[model samples]
Target: MNPVATWRRLLAEFAGTALLVTAVVGSGVMATTLSPDDVGLQLLENSVATAFALGALILTFGPVSGAHFNPVVSAADWFLGRRAGTGLTAGDLGGYALAQTLGAIAGSILANLMFDLAAVDFSGRDRSAGHLWLGEVVATAGLILLIFALARSGRSAVAPAAVGAYIGAAYWFTSSTSFANPAVTIGRAFTDTFAGIAPASVPGFVVAQLVGLAAGAALTLALYPGVGQAADEVVVAHDGGTAPTHAGRP
Candidate 1:
């Protein structure tokens, strides 16, 4: 791809992730404000907002960057597509990850500023527990499985709504409230709000997520042996109906 096109994709990842995190952190703040005495209500409000925003962001940016707001997704795309030579190159993967991470951080700051809180208040909410790690693994694994399954089955059309609905449900089913995305997890750490995960908890969550990514990939391959053929279209095909042909750009 040309430099301009590459930059557009990178910027799409950045902006999409930023807006997603903004919705998450901002809604959490608003939820607490609106439902001061009810944790369940606050979570419901937060999750609903996040789910809607996530789906919208994906629909808006999917054509530009495949709407990969998570490092694991990008990595999985590269891994699955490596053999078939249909997905992102190593350089693009790196760029996407960096942009997403930075965007998450910036999003946290934006949410804090909007809520009149400290810009960089590291979360104190300790979420480091064996069960929480299990939840992360489950959440991330399910997410990967769902995305790849949709791609492999040629059902990418409903990805936006399906992904959003899955995440919203995961929030209630998973013990960790489903911080399925590494970038989102890191972003939540920057805020001391209802959605914030303590900085110390991040490493464990990320590790579990990576493990989940592996498990999910194995499952996808087992279920759809030719899933790799759809790697360039994972989440969604964003190359103007053409898959990226940079198979040699390792």
Candidate 2:
């Protein structure tokens, strides 16, 4: 890719991640206000909104930056494609991760401000349990496995809807509500709403997610030994030469 294309891809990653966080945090606030009496209803509403938004974002941005709003996805792409030379390089990985993380923080603040909340109110919702950690591991691992599997099997075209659907289902099935993305976990800590995670709990979630990343990579390799050949097409192929980013799920 040209220098201009690099910048463009970076911009797409930033904007896509920012909007994804906005949807997650914003919808949580809306769900609470709309259904204050029922936690289950709030979760359902939030999950539905997030699923739709995530799929849309992937479709919109996948052509530019692979829509990889999650650091783990980028890392996975690099690791898997290192031998094949088809995924993100080390420098590109760093840039993508930084952009995604900054975008996520901005998104959290945007969502809070839109809902009349403080700009940077750290969440107090404690989610520091062993079971929750286990859930995170499961959620993140499953997510990685799904995306890579789609790539390896030449089915990445359906990743947008498939990834969204998997996340929505994971929300109900996982104990930690499937906060599989480290960027998202950090962003959610900035708001004390229905979807926020406490700042103190962010570390554990991130660690679990990393663990999940490893597990997912192992599973994918075992299932599809030739997955490395499709590393550049993890989520979906893009116009640019680089591998497209994965969906920035919360």
Candidate 3:
């Protein structure tokens, strides 16, 4: 890949993540402030809206950046062989992760400003280890399963929609409110906005997400043996042409 392309992809990731977090956190703030007596209903509305918006954003920007708005998704793509070896380099991961974190923080700050909900407690009252762990497992599993199903079926064209829908559903089904992205989880700690998590609780959420990611990856491989090989070969062939040396996934 050209250096220019790499830079463009990174920038796209930054933009996509920023937009995604903004939609999610921003809507949460709006729903909480505007709802009269149905906070749950408001959150549900916000969740679905965020899902559709995020899907649109991914479809609009995926071609440019692989639409990796989350580090876990990027890492999963690398493992599934969708990303070229050079594309998943340490530098690339660092850039993407940093961009995602910063974007999420910016989005949270914006949400705070928009609602004047900055002083609200962001942490969920129940932070039990078992509850958090279960939330992470369910949320991450749902996300990875959606991604794997779409990509493996050659329906990469609709991956964004599938992922978005999964996230929206996960919010209601899971206990942790569907924080499947580690970067976003950490970034939410900085603000005490509608979507913010306490900084003290960020590490636990992150660890849960990582564990969930690992479990999801393992399950995907077990369920779809050899599916990743073709993807790896394609990435290898693509990177072989004028790109730097690195190992492809699978």
- Judged by lDDT relative to the true structure, which candidate is superior, 1 or 3? 1
Q: lDDT for every model?
A: 0.88, 0.88, 0.68
The C-alpha stretches of model 1 lying farther than 4 A from their native spots are 1-4, 239-250
Query: Per-residue CA lDDT of candidate 3, range 1-250, in tens?
Result: 2233777777777787877877887787677768857969887878887899888977766666667778886676566654334235556667878887877777666666766666334655334477976898779876876675555544565666677888888888888888899878866765555566777777788888888888887887787654454332211122222222222322
Report the C-alpha displacement of residue 207, candidate 2, in angstroms.
0.3
lDDT of 3: 0.68
What are the RMSD figures for all models against the true structure?
A: 4.1, 4.2, 5.3
Clashing pairs in 2: 65-245, 66-244, 66-245, 67-245, 68-245, 68-246
Better of 2 and 3 by lDDT: 2
Per-residue lDDT value at 164 in model 2: 95
* Candidates by TM-score, descending order: 1, 2, 3
Error of 3 at 82 (Å): 9.4
